[model samples]
Target chain A: MIRIANGQGFWGDSVDAPGRLVEEGPLDYLTLDYLAEVTMSIMQKLRRRDPAAGYATDFVDLVKTLLPRLVEKNIRVVANAGGVNPQSCRAALRAVARAAGFGGLKIGVVSGDDIFDRLGEILDAGCPLANMEDGRPLSEVSERVLSANVYLSSYPIAEALAGGAQIVLTGRSTDPGLVLGPMIHEFGWERQDWDRLAGGTVAGHIVECGAQCSGGNFTRWWEVEGWDHLGYPVVEADPDGSFIVTKHEGTGGMVTEETIAEQLVYEMGNPRRYVTPDVVADFTSVHLERCGPDRVRVSGARGAPPTDTYKVSISYLDGFKAVGQVTIAGPHAIAKARVCAEALWGRLRRAGFTYQETLTELVGLDSCHGTIPQPPSHLNEVVLRVGVKDRDRAKVDRFGKEIAPLVTSGPPGVTGFAGGRPKATEVVSFWPALIPKELVRTTVTVEKAAG
Target chain B: MRRVPLSRIAHARSGDKGTGSNVGLIAADDRGYEILLARATAEKVKAHFGGIVRGVVERYEAPNLRALNFILHDSLGGGGSASLRTDAQGKTHALALLMMEIEIPDDYQTPYPEGSPSKGPPAEGLSAPRRKSR
Candidate 1:
């Protein structure tokens, strides 16, 4: 059995997790997933400002901290920290490794998932790159597209591992691909090994969110212990496509059939068909059993061939938006908050400024669930949040200016407006499309740290 | 028949998918699973959410895990960064769903008994503790 553990759930996850995962247990491979749907667009914006600033900078510091332990323990690292630019990330890692005196460190770089430059060529070749949600053609938002990347399979990651790199960095790969890649490399699983691929993919999904599968977000929060030092999830995967989901000994968090069940259905669409680039896993067929303390054995995961097309994540600057909030205190807080919101909108309209979309929420009351039955008759305070979105940046900016004036002009008890006027920020919206699998190609290269 | 909140028999977790949200409701036991399968229909769930959800609701069964997955379409204002609502990702939708009340047989036994710590005091205006059959 190979021991693989996930440390970082997302880009802004716990900073101490990666090092703690290495120090706490026996791990053969460590995987970190950093990319989310909108992350690539942010990276693209960063790259446009400074050529070498696109990738996850936190990853470089993390590797610097864990490099010694990783080399001593012979642990291989796989991560999608190379957001939009793996070459620059590789260079940064090479510099860090060399400075840290691990000159012989081999880092693999995976590219070709990014198709931003080739969008016109591909679209001209008959692939419309239409939006999957509304079936809108790309021509509607072509000029505003910020980042375009295909969700690559685990094959390139596995190839990098086989090339003898201690660390593999990729761009726009699936979250499960980071874990499944090591399984493919260590067990030598072929591309068509549907059952085994499905098994690894299932394991990947469980631990990808760090402690969410363990105890961090369990529904029975009262039953879980050791919140200060919760153990992240680890997988003891076998070649037969079955795995054990457990954490380190004497660590916090409980891993039972129920916790595993909750995580199994997290962010899930269809239980019968969990689609990834490698295989379409049948989540409904998965069997979970409490084999031991804090250990759940998962088996019977079935799979079928993947689709002919690969889903592409594209982000564009939809518009500009600004949100501002103020606190209303004293009795009748909810009523006063509503009045404040109305007066702000009323002032904006009188100034000859109207936005494309506007939202007003009394955050403390029914903002979340939308007017649940029998709300409390009285409250001490309520936060009045107002926002506006528009194609014209000036209109959104004007809406932001209207929020702070409510502190002195609008209501009796308005405060908490110390932050001043909210600035209009670009709204980077997600656009999911599909491209034929054959149209995308991936390349992997291994480079040694320059001493 | 007696009505109790679904939280007494099941637990849930939810997350967003573009403009929609997926809630995974898992029963506490085999009997609870049957209760959910019978009472937590897609139509009922849609009605329970009321104006909170704008589009259709679809439910899928996962018998292996004693769980039912419900997908609420067009629920978020726009979802992700595009959404203007406070709960852009629908993280609290699971607890909102657990607030739903379902009718059970008068003689039925629950894993979380009445007055237990897990089953907190009944919400205001609920019928006082009594056993009856419809």
Candidate 2:
């Protein structure tokens, strides 16, 4: 039996949590998730200037902080911190390990998800890279794409583990696959055990979001206590592929059936058809019970065959957008804010500065109005936020410039528009599509740094 | 298609028959779901059935938990004993029909994001309970 613990759901999670998870509990493997859709683009921008800057730098510092304890305790680490730049991530991790006096650590890197250099080649080879959302081909924004990654599964990670890697770093893998890979390694589970494989996938999903399953975002949250120091979830896996999801004893968070249930429904779409690269688990087949304090036994999860295709997250340049807000105060503030926003758009439209998508929101007035069914009607102040997105940056910039003018010309109560115009920023849009698993190949390499 | 809750499904009693398993369907959410599950679990179910299930397709409804169930024939590759994924479409169909039978609770609500294609729909039905944010 092996105990696997996940310390991060995404980049920018609690810095001390991973170290705390290892120090406070007994764990064989530790995993962290540190990448997101827009994060790739941000890292790409960072990499353009510095060759060693594309990966998750936060993870390097984290490793340096936890290396001593990890080596002392014998806990293996796996993470997808190698965003867009695996080699750099490897180099950085090695540097950290060496600096921490751990010179013989072998770091494994999983690569080949990056298709940035081959975008035109793929398109030229008759792969349109069609947008699954609108069915538009990749030719639409091939030139504007910052990053394109095919989400890989846990197999490559298992290979890394077999290769004697003390730490495994990956780029653009399914979040759940990180935890599932460790389980496959610990249990010696075969690839054909779809039932057991699906069980691991279910466990991954339950704890993928870090503290979320423990008490980070429960709807019945008031029932929980000591959330100020809520502990993240840790999984204890047995040889038979069964596991118990729990947290450190005396931790602040609550792990009950309701907490797990709420986490299960946090961002759910279809209850019965939960899709992952490993298997499509039947959420209904899952059973959760509070066996003891800080421990919940999750078992009996049923799974079906996995889909033939994997979802690809492609973020491309949609357009440019800029938003500017001005606070309107005093009597008739709401009306004044409305007129100010309209006057800016009217002037921009008259100046031939049109946008593909334009929006105006009265933040203090009715931001969550329509959805909540009852939005406040009376308000003494309102913040007028006007934004525009278009292929033309000048047009979006023009829309931004029009907001501050309301203070002097359009509305009497306009104030707090001292920042001038909001800068025109590139709009990143998501494209969800599927590619046959066979078409993509992931490779893993174990590298050691030199002095 | 039937709909059931996790709470209701937990109370369900599962029976085994010499490695072959039998459990009544209490509720199912949609027809496509059973298809999804069958695609993932055809081999395992076949192993449990001790081979292929080739007779009639049986169906039952659990309004309380909202599920359905079906039983298949000798579909397991090794004479209803081995669990392999290379099953025939008929066997896959029978397995898809079988998943609809698990009983779900009346209050079974979805517990995670379903990774849908559409973007910008604030995940509904969550009321933010005020507590110190962690």
Candidate 3:
């Protein structure tokens, strides 16, 4: 069995979790997932400002901290921290390794997931590049498109591992691919091994969120112990397409069948068809059993062939938005909060600065779950949060200025506006499209750090 | 029959999918699964959400996990970075769903009994006051 642990759930996950996984356990591979749907756009913006500033810099520091141990333990690392630029990420890692005295470190770079520059050529070649959700053509927002990347399969990562690279960095690969890649390389699983691929995919999904399946954000929060030091998940995958989800011994958090079940259905669409670039996994066919404390054995994952196309995540400049909030205290907090919101909007409208979209929420009352008919009587305080989105940055900015004035001008007992006026931030919207699998070609290259 | 909140026999997790959000409800036992299968229909879930979910609610069943997943379309004001609401990702929709009350037999055994510490104190004024039968 090969032990693979996912430490980072997203771009801004716990920094200490990855190092903790290496220090606390016997692990063969450490996988870190850094890219989210909208992360590429942010990276693209950064690259435009400074060429070397795009990739996840946190990863460089992480490798620098764990380089000596990683070499000694022979633990291979796989991560999609490349963002929009895997080569730059690899260069940064090489510099870190050389500085840390691990000059012989081999880092593999996976490219071709990013298709931002080739958007026009691909679109003109009869691929409409239409939005998957609304069926809108790319022409509508093509000019505003900042970054476009295809979600590559696990094959590129496996190729990197097979080529003897100790660390593999990829751009825009699927989150689960980070785990499944090591499973394929260690077990020598064939390309058409549908059942095993599905099993590995299921295992990847369970632990993709790091500690989500190991007590973090669990529904039964009271049952899980040791919130201060929760354990990130590790998958003991075998050749026969079954795996055990467990954390390091004596670690915080509990791994039960229920925790596994909750993560199984997380962000799931059709249970019978969980599609990835590698294979179509049947989440309904998965079987979970509690083997021991902090261990859940998962098996019976069935699979079918994947689709002919790969889903591409594209982001564009939608508009600008700003949100501002103020606390309303005293006996009629909810009522006063409502008045504050209405007056702010009234002021904005009178200035002829109507926005494309606006939202007013009484946070302590029903902002989250919507307007519940009977909010508790005699609430002490409610935060009045007002937000506005518009194509015009000035309009969104004007809406922000109205929020703080409510303290002295609008209502009684208005405070907590110490942050001053909110500034308009660019709204980077997601546009998902499908590209023919053959259209996107991925390549893997391995290089050693120069002394 | 006695009416109790669904939290007595189930747990849930929710996250965003585009402009929509998915809530996966897992039962405590086979008996609770049966109760969920019967009572947790798409129509009822849509009605329970009120104006929060502006679009349709689609439900999918996974008996292997004793879970039912509901997809709430067009629910997040716009979802992701485009959304103006605080809970743009619909993260709290799971607990909001657990707040739904259901009817079960008086002798039904719940994993979380009414006064059990695991169930914790009842949420303030979530449910209507019980009326004494004449």
In DockQ terms, which candidate is top?
Answer: 3
Candidate 3 chain B lDDT trough over 10 residues, lowest sum: B115-124
lDDT of 2 by residue, A71-119 (tens): 8898999899999898998888888888877888888999988877766
lDDT of 1 at A196: 92
Chain A TM-score values for every predicted structure, listed in order? 0.98, 0.93, 0.99
Residue A376 accuracy (lDDT) in model 2: 55
Per-candidate fnat, comma-separated: 0.75, 0.00, 0.72
**Candidate 3: residue A172 Cα off by (Å):** 0.5
**lDDT comparing candidate 1 with the true structure:** 0.90
User: Each predicted complex: what DockQ?
Assistant: 0.52, 0.02, 0.59
User: Model 1: per-residue lDDT, tens digit, B1-134?
Assistant: 89998878888999898889999999999989999999999999999898889999999999999999999999887867788888888898998898899998887786654443455443544565544433
Candidate 2 is graded, for docking, as: incorrect
Q: Lowest-lDDT window of 10 residues in candidate 2 chain A?
A: A366-375
Residue-level error in angstroms, candidate 1, position B96: 0.7
What are the C-alpha RMSDs, in order, of all predicted structures? 4.2, 13.9, 3.4
Q: Distance from true position, residue A394, model 1, in Å?
A: 0.4
Global lDDT of each candidate: 0.90, 0.67, 0.90
Candidate 3 chain A worst ten-residue window by lDDT: A370-379
**Per-residue lDDT of model 3, residues A62-163, tens digit only:** 999999998999999999989998899998899989988878888999999999999999998899989999999999999999999999999899999999
**Regions more than 4 Å wrong, model 3:** B118-134
